[model samples]
Each structure stands twice: as structure tokens, then as C-alpha cells.
Target: MGHDRIDPEGIADPVDDLYSQVVVSSGEKTIHVAGTTARDSDGLVVGETYAEQIEQTLTNVEASLAAAGADPADVVRQTIYALDCDAFVEEAYPHVVDFYGDDALPASALIGADSLADPDYLLELEVTAVLEE
Candidate 1:
């Protein structure tokens, strides 16, 4: 596979590997996806808890990327919206691990809101990917 890795220079503190960077470059085709929530493929609400919804939302994103022939490594940017932003590190971290892996995660901006479209909806995530040529 012909590809180039995108490296991020700012680490602020400790990095397991100095050579490690964030994001990767693949094909010329780029996919930009809007924020996907725990809503099912049919756009119906799913999950009852914050964590479950977060994972479901990510799974949705994963499937979308795969459908476009991309993987988590192909992700260039990720953005998440939470009803309660403060709960992110504890609630959504695990689900996010699958995307980040052993390497640095993508550049992300998380937002907090008083609520979501549905009171049951807890989290939503959006992603951008570059498909390898």
C-alpha cells in the first residue's frame, strides 16, 4: 500500500516514542463525515447509558469508514460532542482507545452542551479520513 504518515510535533510532555506522530495519509480520496451519534443505521436512538452510546456512535463511524475502505489509521481528524463534557475522560475513553491504539490519537476538539437532540443521547463523534490510493 502506498502511503505517507502525518506527524504531529507538539507533545507538551511525555511521549513513549519521539518518532511517533498523529494521523496518517493514504489515498487521494478524502472522506468527510458529519458527527455521528448513537443513533442506529436507521437514525433511531440506541443505548441507555453514556458509555454505551459513545461506543455505539464510534462503531457507527468505524463502519462508515470501512464502507469507504478506510480504517482508524486513515482518520485525520475526530470531533466529539457530549452532553456533559467533563465526563469524557472517564466515560468515553475506552471506546476511543480502539481508534487511537498505541500511537498518538488524532487532533480532536470536544464540545460540551446543555443537552443533545434527544435527552437519551449522550455522545456523538465525527471523523475525517483519507483513503489510500
Candidate 2:
């Protein structure tokens, strides 16, 4: 692993070191993924609550990564966009922890959006992965 995680002073360090304020990685191949949402293959949205939506969205992200010959462990960075940050932090973060697991966690950011593409859509996920030569 050639990834370096930085947590500078004055910034609150993340719990469990699951995420870093900054992450740097060097690899022969890199994958950029578009924002993934909770919609299933049938074009129907999944999940009634934010946590459910998060799980579905992460699942979609995982599939996308796999399609690119990568996986969660290859992810160097991840960004989450949500309609409700408070609810997501309280209700959804735990699920995210379970989704990625401890060793597979990557550098991440969470953005609170006013709304998503659809009113029923609660969140979206985007990720970048690296594969060393």
C-alpha cells in the first residue's frame, strides 16, 4: 500500500482513524466513479429511511467499482452527498462503517445538499480507486 493519510493539527481527528483529512496514493491504474444512488435495476428507488438508502447506494457503488476491476479496498477517496446531513450522520454513518468495514475504509468527505436529483432520493456516493502496478 502506497497510500498516505494525513491528519493535520488543529483539525479534529476522526474517530477510529477510519478516514483521513487528506489521502495520497500512487498507482498504475485509477478509477473514477460517478455518483451512485439508491435506485435498483428496475429504476425504482430502494429504502424508506436514510439508512436504508445509504446501504443501497453503497451497494451500487461497490458494483460500479467491481465493474471497473476494483473494490472497496482499492478505493482511495470517497465523497457522500446527502439531503439531510444531520440525519445521515446520526442514522446512516453507522451503516456506512459496516458497509466499508475497518480495513477497507478510505478517505472521505460528506456534503449536505439542499436536495437530490429526486425528492425521494436521500443520498449519492462517488469514489476513486487506485490499483498499483
Candidate 3:
């Protein structure tokens, strides 16, 4: 398995490694996680605030990664869907940075959306990863 993160010289660096400019990876297996939200084990929405929901969402993503025999470092791409993009960046981004850390940051996109599958859901995460078989 191999994974290489790249930030070309011309492109300005992302603040605090929030994401990579490009991610090149190869492995025996690939994991594609569906959009995950801040729902708990009993199918209840987890948090009231954006930060709290983001934290729980990340936890769900972590669990999905583990179930696929992968980890944060194995993640190559991530798509974040938020009801409020600005709030996500301002209030909830810290939790994301803490979850992935600087070294394991993946190529990511944060998208603003008006609604989700559930009314209470504030954010959703979709992840793609690679791992050795």
C-alpha cells in the first residue's frame, strides 16, 4: 500500500493542513463510505449545535473506517456537506482538524446545502479510503 499527499509549489498552502491539494494512493483494497451524519445508535440526532454534531459525525466516520479495516491515514478523499458552510468553518472546523490531525489530512471539499435527509442533521460526511488487503 502507498499513499502520497501533494501540494504543488504554485498553489498556496492550506491553513494548518486542513486538506491536501492532491492525494495519490494505491492499495489492494478501497473503501467507499456513504454519507454519514450525527445520528446515534438509536437513530436519534446527536447534537444541538454545529460543533457538537460535527464531532459526532466524525466519530461515526471513524467507526466506518475501522469497520473497513482502514484508518484516517488511509483516507484519500472526503466530501463534507453542511447546512451552513460558514458555521462549519468557523465553529466546527477545529474538531475536524483534531480528528484527522495534520499528517493524515485528506483531499477534501466542503459544500453548502439547504437540507439533508433529516431535518435535524446539520452536516454529513462522505469518505473514500484505501488499504492493503
Candidate 4:
């Protein structure tokens, strides 16, 4: 698999290190992970705070990626939905950086939503990954 992170000229760079402006990737297999949230196997909300919820959400995302034979480094894109975008940026950003790392960050978007499927869910993650074989 090959993944190239790009920030094209004329397009001002993103202010934060959470993502790249563009991601060019090639691989033999592609994986799409459905929207994942901070829910446990028993179907209960996992956290009361943004930090805790984001961590559980990422854990869920990792499990989904592993089930598909992929990992965080293979991810090329992500969509993040948060109940409170500001709180997510302030409290949950570190967990995100820790999950993907600065070097392996993917093209991403963080959206603020009025609510989630479960009222207790604080965030959701959708990811796309590629595998070499």
C-alpha cells in the first residue's frame, strides 16, 4: 500500500495537525468502517465526557479495522461527528492524535451534530483504510 499526504499550494494548510489536506492512496484492498461510537458489546454508552467517549470510540474503530485486516496506519480518511465540536477539539483532540499519530494522520473532517443515535453517545467515527494485499 502507498499513502501520500499532500497539502497543495494555493490551498492554505490546515491549522491543526489532526489531518492532511489531501490523501492519495493506492492498494489492492480497501476497507470501509461504518460509523463507530462509544458503545460497548452490551450496547450501553461508555463515557460521560468527551475525552472518555472519544477514547472508547477509537477503540471501537480499531476493533472494526482489525476485523477487516487493517490498522490505523492503513487508514486514509476519517469523518468525525461530535455532539459538541468545541469540546471535542479541546478535550478529545489529544486522544485522536495519540491514536493516529502526527505522521500517520489521514484526511479528515470533524463535524458538529445536534445529536447521535443514542442520546448518550458523544461522538462517532467513520474510517476508510487500504491494505497492500
Candidate 5:
């Protein structure tokens, strides 16, 4: 849990409540999670809308972090991919902030992908977290 989120003094702060300009993690254990899509335990794609897909995908990310003994607040970096990138940024991005609350949002990237592993898949998430000793 030893980390610092920087917005930098000179740069225009990011408008989305999604990420920081930089994240510095000073911890012994780091967890690298693979990109995860909005698939349920049955391996079925969940949600048809962008918001639902993003929510389920973030929920999956949270589960991955918990299994690794890390919390969302410990996340140092996050990369999100969406098949409908424009809609994701414009409509669905704000929903994630509700999950993370208002502190230490991870340094993030939102990418547009032509497709995911499944045609029904709309969003995927990957994160790196530093576990507090």
C-alpha cells in the first residue's frame, strides 16, 4: 500500500475521474494481472451494454486483485480496452469512479480494440497492484 499518485503541477489535470498522471509504488510484492473481459464464472460474456460490460469487467478485476491479496487502492496502473471505445469513454468511463471512490485513482489507459476474444465481449481490464507488507 505504499504508493503516491501524482497529477503534476504544470499539466492540465485529466477531466475524467479515472486516472492520475503518475503512480509511484514502493512495495515488495507487486501483482500483475492479465487482461480480463466481462465473462462470468460459467465463461459466458455478461452484459450487452457498455456500462454493464465495464462494470462486470471491473468487478472481475477486483476479484483478481483480492485473490492476489491486493486492494483496488493498491493498484498502480490500469489499462482498459473496449470494442466501442468512443462510447466507453463518453458514456461508461464515469461509472468506474463509483467503484474506486475518490482517492488514488490508478494511472490508466483507455484503448480501443477491434475485437476481444469473444465477439460478445465489449470491455476488458488489466491492472498492476503493489501489495502492502
Candidate 6:
């Protein structure tokens, strides 16, 4: 038997993306993964840059959706939050492709925020997925 991993060489941290992602799921299930902020499992905001937090939070979202038996395509809706909206949309937003293929995306809404759960929490994404039976 062999092991397979997701995007190993891409992310510098080398940590299993699933550390904050879902690898498998099943059945007709409706899962509500709580809105995940950039805050780490320890509940500490991870970065000062919107890009940093956005990246981590999105990773968590991918995992959570997978755990719910959904893929990026399974997501029917999404919402993104940013402290300084313009900066992210112009700069980091392009990276969204990393979350769910840049070319193919689900219905989504973005908001310019004054702040999030934490000041360092520059960006966060919440999604809804329906697991097909």
C-alpha cells in the first residue's frame, strides 16, 4: 500500500493540508462547518497580512467541506470577508483559485469588513455544501 497527499510541495509549511481539511466523507449529509477565521487550532490569529490569514482560513474550509462529503464543486454558496476590502480584492483575491480552481468557482459574495473575530483575522470564508447521495 502507498500513501497519497494533497499539494505537498506547494505549501512551504509541509504540514498535511488536511490538518485543517477533510479527506473523506459519505452518505446524504448536510454539514455546517462553522465559519473559520485565520485563527489557528490554538485560537491564535496567524498573520498580520490579509493574504496569510485568508490562505489558512480557506485551507480550513476545504478540509471542512471534504469532511462533509463535498468537494469545491459541491459548494453551492460562499462568502468572503476582508478587513480592508480593496487591498485583498486587488492583490490576494487572485489566489482564490488555489482554493477551488481559479477557473471554476461557486456562487460567492465578498464584503469589506472593519474587523473580524480578531484584528489579525484579515479574511475568512464561509461555505455551504450539499453532499450527494
Model 1 lDDT tens row, 1-58: 4334455456453232222244456567898888788888787888877678887787
Tens-digit lDDT string for candidate 6 (1-103): 1111233445453122212222232336555667788777787777777677777787788878877666765564567887777877766666665666533
TM-score of each: 0.77, 0.88, 0.94, 0.96, 0.92, 0.70
What's the CA error at residue 122 for candidate 1, in Å? 1.2
Comparison by TM-score, 5 against 6, better one? 5
Model 4 per-residue lDDT tens digits across residues 11-70: 988767668899999889999999999998898889899999988899999999999899
Give the C-alpha lDDT of model 4.
Answer: 0.90
In candidate 5, the residue pairs with backbone N, CA or C atoms under 3 Å apart (3 or more residues apart, or in different chains) clash, namely none
Off-target runs (Cα >4 Å) in candidate 3 are none
lDDT of 6: 0.63
> In model 5, which regions exceed 4 Å deviation?
none
lDDT tens digits, residue span 34-129, model 3: 999999888999998889998889889999999988888889999999999888888898888888888878899999999999999999999999
Cα lDDT over the full model 1:
0.70
- Angstrom error of the Cα, residue 78, model 5: value is 0.4
Candidate 5, residue 96: the lDDT equals 74
Clashes of each: 3, 0, 0, 0, 0, 2
Taking all chains together, the TM-score of candidate 4 against the true structure is: 0.96
Q: How much lDDT does each candidate structure score? A: 0.70, 0.84, 0.90, 0.90, 0.83, 0.63
Give one digit per residue, the lDDT tens place, for model 5 in 67-124. 9888788888889888877899876788777766668688888888998888898888
Ranking by TM-score: 4, 3, 5, 2, 1, 6
TM-score of 5: 0.92
> Pairing residues by index, what is the TM-score of model 3?
0.94
